[model samples]
Target chain A: MPTDPKNPSGASTINGTDAVDSRRKPGAAEKSWEEKTLVPTLAKSPERASKFTTVSSYPIRRLYTPADLSGWDEDRDLGLPGEPPYTRGIHPTMYRTRLWTMRQFAGFGTAEDTNQRFRYLLAQGQTGLSVAFDLPTLMGYDSDHALSEGEVGKCGVAISSLADMEVLFDKIPIADVSTSMTINSPAAVIWAMYLAVAEKQGADWKKIAGTLQNDILKEYIAQKEYIYPPEPSMRLVIDTIEFGAKHTPKFNVISISGYHIREAGSTAIQELAFTLRDGIEYVDWALRRGMNIDEFAPRLSFFFNAHSDFFEEIAKYRAARRIWHKTMTERYGAKNARSWALRFHTQTAGCSLTAQQPYNNVVRTALQALAAVLGGTQSLHTNSLDEAWALPTEFAATLALRTQQIIAHESGVTNTVDPLGGSYFVEALTNEVEAGAWDYIRKIDALGGMVAAIERGYPQREIADAAYQYQMEVDRKEKIVVGVNDYFTKENPLDILQIDESVAHRQAERLAKLRAERSSDEVARRLDGLRIASQGKENLMPYIYDAVKAYATLGEICDAMKVAFGIYDEVAIT
Target chain B: MSEKRIRVLIAKPGLDGHDRGAKIIARALRDAGMEVIYTGLRQTPEMIASAAAQEDVDVIGLSILSGAHNTLGPRLMELLREKGMGDVCVVIGGIIPEADIPALKKVGIAEIFLPGTPTQAIVDFIRSRISAAPSKA
Candidate 1:
């Protein structure tokens, strides 16, 4: 076997093809052991199935030894935490310094109603705020718009104007707690409203810390909430990154998200590969926009999904960090260490939850949360048990928050950084995930980055195929999802929280009152200015900020921009 | 009688963006010898009712995850009635709180399918429901 003097694993090179080589081969002794000991045991009990594979379809071997990683270079591949490449972990101290932020996503009903929920969660020891906008707001429709009739304040909190934003953060200080808004399409406009609200709160823009899910690429590829076409949409994203880098240095302008992609039924490896590729695409665009790598890269954060696959999820995170480090340092020549680090927030998979035996979701979320913790996430949001049914009830959401607290305090996992870092299986799996992701990245690069690849429906088709394949497996009983295909039980559905029906009417009234009171002339002037700027090369942030300050509704501003930028018609792939 | 494929209009009303369930149902229906017209996401009740009429679909399936089902579901049923397309059997799915199910059914939502439901179950339900209806073709 090849040996390296420096590698802790006593292996050799960890770069290019050498790293892909298996370290040890089965000798006559192993063969005899398999035949004598393994074959007899298998004859009695037999393997549970003909084959075993991970959720991502990575075939599981009977055993992994030095043979599996014969040329693995520990130092080169798995470095110390907080070091270059960040394969082990991002921070040297990791959870020892502080646990990942327990940010529970909460938003429903009117702004005041959601504000109360936010306060309640904060009081219950939730660290940060994650705002889930209602359908009208998410789609950039006014509360009173014809299309938004039944959707106002339904799925999430409805914020149609700066007035609603002000109420949503009514007593909450903008400067103290970092907020993450799950908004896209009209992300620039929503972000401008947030800035206006912060200004109203008299908070320094530079001191505001938060993340905007301004990931338009993933929207097109997975989420299907896209408003503009690819080129102009990317331009809007770069504008925010440049603006955030210059002004709000503490804020992450674009949260390149794999959460929605995974929720849309992408395999773990696809989520990793496609998300990282999206991040790379953004960086390329920003670089081409005359921005330095280090200036904006540090502020760019990622959002990932922590699915049910324990090792697969953890390995995905580790692989993501390593791939990002290599790309930033070697590919982009990023000098800043922070630029090489891939800081990400993870949410336990909502799609993994089952409506039957809904309480099982709590257990599933705990395992997913543990995987995320071990994977060294910067932030986590454990999904509630009732999420599969509807918006989580208060009791369920509190229990979900308690899940994270238990992991942080009781689980004892936070005691060390990268506690499972040196495991042979984890290391081997990490390499496999990285190699798989690299293959996808190279394929995407050959197609001239994500935009071109998305136009050709590359990632979309891949996700759809994986989703269909998984469904087929589930249907055929090849996959045993508890309470789904196996251990089937017909139980009464659990009590789910229903959104108050009056929310839409109340929000519409609020919108009407605001519209009646606001200065019409000023709103018109700023909107005209915004429309003019949208037709030019000017950053849309300032113009959007101006229009938002004039108390223009989201739909009005988005409509004005639509006139200039036009809307995108999605090419249905599936 | 003319043999016609069961035309199902699967529209996601409101802006939940949770299309996995919708797409699964669409594909399943298509596989089960049905012409499934999926109108993508953020489709309004009006748009759905109009599409159901224009497409001459035999069934209208509304997949809504955004708790706006109580509002959107009834309104969509009403719109279909206004269009005199009451023959269009409406089915609702996705994340509907059980408490609201009675109200939804009262407003003419023929069926409700929650999560963890198999695609075959949905397909079977559509087939059984449509086969019972008198042929218009």
Candidate 2:
């Protein structure tokens, strides 16, 4: 996300008047409709009143008549859904015909433990599988590795091999349920493990479908998980894109993610802009590899963070769709409408969770999830109330799922298409977020795209500046965080979930047994063949599947390549 | 003694390579006129302690979001004690539960700043906690 020296925090640009500090006006805050006439509205007359505001603080006007979005040509800017420049949505009847995939992210401890969780979620009626690999796997290391000792499955599932991934999805119908892995640096290997699991189940390559958070650019900017230099990383992404395009067309090769970037403290616009920029960078890499834009582009998906801001998140999504549409159709010459559509999965803001007043996170998450739904997310995940404490407990996870259900069934907001689209505030904020994001997109273009900007530490610096400034505002009491800086109560009343550390030891014991039971010789031959394939131009998925089927560990496959490509220790940006 | 730069080591020990907190703190400390040495992501406790020893930093700022802080923070403090660097201040910030603070403090953690603790407080804590460079008396 580009940082304007003027509006550095993105959320600070709008004057404080947008949200009347509820602390000062109890009557105004409590009285919803009748007593709210004191608050000025630009909708009454745009020229007479101040503009609406995005979460990032970008000023949005009260009304977006054709005048607000002045130069935007309807045919050029706002095209029909599933058509080139898919500003509306990828599917015309987005939630009307089909409910978005209920993909809850779940995984913790060893592969078997996470596997049990997958089956549980599936049994609980989850439609899609989403993987949350541990820090060790995300950082490209095996569980037993000293660097990964206690970290094995602390944050997510510890996947060391096809053996583990197999345990993870045991009886969970990989062929029937589409899966999405939130792995980046080791995404290719992890994806290969999933394919191996599917193959062992007698599913063909074309039949297995899932998504990989293969967007490595964010690794440099926020996530800090990269195995190779940008060049080789781009090579790995192109390999997957090309492979998926040719074989499993249903598979989403890459999920351009803004979740981490936002979690790393980027403002809403930064998340939107940086995420879109990373997507363009991937397309450029694939295009350079001689793959047609439409072939791989149509399968590319996105992941976003639905933050605490209600209207801001909705506007951010609308802006993302518009920006991606224009960038793909106008910039990349994406002939296919599918290529232009910005189909994205959203998760409620985990960063917004507070360890203080932990139950407050549920209300925060519900609001964020509703924003995601109204924003037209293709899929959504609601963070559990107790996630700020530890991996969600069964009770907490159920509540999180129920939160989504309540929004879907109880909430009638979905009765209309683009429910918030015509709002004077939403449309204006949508245009503002889009403009703010383009400011960065244009700068990245000037600097020769995301790869070059990353090399120059542009995105990294921009995110830092925004985070720093936002912190400054929060500290100065300019921004009111309910329990943090303002209205904070010393007597904290929140239930925090506690997971026993013994879970890891038990998981490791099961894993060691799984490894001992598998044939070592088969693992060796398959892994050796994978290493050989890596030396050449073969699409690495088949070889990866073979290695995974042989019960080869993710570490073995990543280690072979780390020897060739070397691991990426992020260059300290500060 | 003149206000010599406060040398701080910002580390991500034990693989929850979440450096956002560490990075923000580093930038804040640096802006506050301190010399910050950031050990990049995925550093082990031994590696972090070794770097702190070699660098002779006045403060070790451990950022652990992996929930391994319970195990990792204690281990680092014990290693610091073993290394005869017990006087060196150790401050940790992350997703640490409030209940664990007393136990961590008992192990001689100089301070534990949880998430959302303003960066200025950290800057101030470091400035005040890092024993003034032996007055040239």
Candidate 3:
């Protein structure tokens, strides 16, 4: 018997041919395994094995062995954690020392409402806070702006001025708990606003720890929450990196994100590859500004998507750590050990949550959350069950928070470090994912890094293809989504949460009052100063901090600069 | 000679930045042989209505993950009517509570595709509606 060239497994590899490869006559005993099994296998015949392709459509073997990672070296490839080439895990003890940060993405409705959720989460043993800003805040508009209209507290918390920010963090000790702000384009301004509120609370900047998702490269590629074009955006990111290095020692200027890319329908491999490329672009920008790679790289954290494909997602994270470490030490000549380690925050896959059978999402989220712990994440945010339908209800959100808590305290998975490290299947998949990502990185380098590739729509096209292939598999009943395809239930009413539209109306009124009370002269002067600074080569943090101190509205601040910076209109794909 | 391919504009209107549904739909429409234009994140009703007229698209699908769908949907419809472009079939997609669907219908929405709906269903629905239109001749 000859092994099928395409079929790594004994199962015949189906490549759009037929149900099974019929070229060779099957022995009389071959069909016995399929017919006699207590449970029916997904694909009984070898020829129907294409369904096992990973999210990127890379064919997966049913089992993996040492032979799959034949070329891997222990010292050169999988070095000790907290060392260069950190494939095994980031820190030496990983979760054994301290479990990954259970940072739930909490924010919705008005500032006051979101504040309660934040306080509740922190009170329930949540170590860190991750802010989710409304569309108005994310898109650089204050709550009262006409353009803000019906969206103030629609998607996330509405922050208009320092008053809102002050109220949002009212009783919470910003100094003690680390925070992560998921803001990109207008990152500098929002960060400065946070800084202002912290100062008013008498919190020392040096003692406060948090992350601003200031990585603008990913915004251009996946999350279209960008305000200015690439050049100015990159400038702002570099400005943050520079400012953080000089002032806020504990602050991570940016969290280079693959989470958004994955959420934007990118494959796991594409997310890893494009995200690393985006990270490299940031380092390049900082280096060009004469900043040392080691100075800002340690705190250069990452955010990832923990999808339902348990093994694949785990492999993706492990590969991400290895690739970043290798690229930093070997390629960029990074001297610091921290510079080589790829610290990351993971969130359970938002796209994987099905609106049908809303409760099933809790199980999916728990499974993905477990994978993140085994995958060696430094921090994580678990998706609420009802989010696929709406902003999670208080009950559902508490369940989501408890999901992470149970995994951390009871699961025993966190008792050990990188529990899946030496597994044959996981290691093999890690190697496979790393190689796939490396191949893309090389191709992107050929196209002159992430920006040029983005301009050519390379990453977008690849993500589109992967997304399309995944949908096709789902349609063909190959990759069964329990609630969607396999389990057929008729008209089960899902308990969906509803945010009242009045939240936005009230937020808008608050913004109007805040604007009227602020000194008009101070706002005008700060805004004008920011505009003039935008024309020069000055670091934007100081300018943004000044504007935020003057209580300049988010929209007014963005508009003053959008005039000089000009709006970014993406060129249609060629 | 190249036939004029159906150019569609898929917009996320009125501060609803949750675009997983819209992005999937846009890609599906594009794959179904239509040139899709996606205006990413947090668009106002006026901006969307103006864009619909400016792009001169065959269809305008408003994707709202935010609960302001009731208010935002009506605002866009009113603006579209004011612009004399009410003929553009604006399909509402995302988590619209069953009770709110009628209110949307009252505001002149032709169709509403909820979260659980398949991508092919949308593609097929758009194709049939576009082909059956008498103005196409």
In model 3, how large is the Cα lDDT of residue A393?
75
Sort by lDDT, top down from the best: 1, 3, 2
**Tens-digit lDDT string for candidate 2 (A420-446):** 655545765676778889998888999
Candidate 3, residue A204: how far the Cα is off, in Å: 1.2
User: lDDT of each model, Cα atoms only?
Assistant: 0.87, 0.78, 0.80
lDDT for each residue of candidate 3 in A1-574, tens digit (9 for 90 to 100)? 2334555344333222233232323334544543454124433433434345665565665444454556677777666676666777877887778877888888888888989999888777888999999888988988776767766776788887777888899998888889899998888888999999889888999888999999888776776777888888888889999999988989998999998888777888899999998999889889999999889888798989999889999999989998998889887999988898898999998888887877899999999999888888889899998776778877888899899989988988877777776787788778878988999999999999888888887887677567667776776666778888779766666576666778877877787788889999999998999999888898978988998898887788888778668877554321
For model 1 the local lDDT of residue A449 reads 93
After superposition, the stretches of candidate 1 with alpha carbons farther than 4 Å from their true spots are A1-24, A27-29, B1-4
- Pairs with backbone N, CA or C atoms under 3 Å apart (clashes), candidate 2: A10-A56, A11-A56, A52-A60, A115-A168, A160-A554
Model 2, B1-137: lDDT tens digits are 77567788999887665677888888889888998999987777789889999988889999877878788888998899899988888999988777778999999898989777889899888877765545222
Candidate 2 to truth, TM: 0.89
Worst 10 residues of 2 chain A by lDDT: A20-29
| Predicted complex 2: DockQ | 0.62
- Give per-residue CA lDDT, model 1, range A1-574, as digits (tens): 1222344231122111232334446567766776677666654654444445676666656565555666779899998999977988899999999889999999988999999999999999999999999878887889888877777777789899999998999999999999999998989999998998898889999999999999999988888887778888888999999999989999999899999999998988899999999999999999999999999999989999999889999999999999999999999999999999999999999989988898899999999999999999999999999888888889999999999999999999999889998788888888888888999999999999999999998998898878877787787777778999789777887777666658888888888899999999999999999889889988889988999998999999999988877888776655
